[model samples]
Target: MLYIFQDETTSTVAPARLYKALTIDGDTIIPKVIPGFRTVEIVEGNGGPGTIKKLTFEEGQHIYVTYALHIYNL
Candidate 1:
């Protein structure tokens, strides 16, 4: 089975800051912002275009893995 989640938001903040928070500081920020996951790990790339992230839910040993792909600028 496969599940997909997508989110899009517009912010008044600087793009660089938002990028840093999403990529650089993401591992640290995720748990605090979304409390259900037991752990979050950057198992692959460093939040780059081909990066991968894993979220673990210990209750059922469920894992959700995701990767990023670079898309042309809007």
Candidate 2:
């Protein structure tokens, strides 16, 4: 059997602008941070749990991921 591991990270950004950026313009924001994707879109949910997001790459391939939106103050 093979095991896969995932790492968790806490990214700190200006809370106010980051919120607006993510909620308003995630497609434009994420690609700048994560390579290999040109654009992203919310396929479901209203910025809550059980949300589905789609990432479209430059080569025309698409990937889907389920996401949760949870923000905390530091």
Candidate 3:
């Protein structure tokens, strides 16, 4: 079985800034703002297609998330 999810939102920030925050600087920023996230590190690949990131949460947290992001140019 397979599942996919999508979400859309509106923001007043410029597209470039938003992209930078979410993609370019996310590893550094997310763990700081979001509780339970102990660290977000790139386990493999450069910051491009096929990148695999490991997100380790604080101890006792029930969720363990890992992302293998395949980015493409639109």
Candidate 4:
């Protein structure tokens, strides 16, 4: 049998912007960093669980991940 592992990390920054080279446009930031990511797409939802995101890369790589939203009243 084989086993798979997954991890998550969260970083916080001001709601400010990054730069023209690294625009804060939606969530498609692959091509900005690599400049050859080809394409990245996201399925929009009103911010909730069960949302799906799809990504495609120039190196023939693809991935699908589901978004789970967590909310807290600070």
Error of 4 at 43 (Å): 2.6
lDDT of 3 by residue, 51-72 (tens): 9899999988866777788644
* RMSD of model 3 against the true structure: 2.3
Error of 4 at 24 (Å): 5.1
Question: Tens-digit lDDT track for model 1 on 1-63?
Answer: 444556899999999999898867878887778767666776777666776677775576566
Best-to-worst ranking by lDDT: 3, 1, 2, 4
Name the runs in model 3 displaced over 4 angstroms. 1-3, 72-74
Candidate 2 stretches with Cα past 4 Å from truth are: 1-26, 60-74
What overall lDDT goes with each candidate model?
A: 0.72, 0.66, 0.86, 0.48
Residue 72 of model 4: what lDDT? 41
lDDT of 4 by residue, 6-57 (tens): 4565546443554332333545566556654665454765434544444455
Report the lDDT tens digits of candidate 2 across residue range 1-74: 33444466666877787668866677688889877777677778775655667777666555554444444444
Ranking by TM-score: 3, 1, 2, 4
- Say which prediction, candidate 2 or candidate 3, comes out ahead on lDDT: 3
The alpha-carbon root-mean-square deviation between model 4 and the true structure, to one decimal in Å, is 6.9
Q: Which candidate wins on TM-score?
A: 3
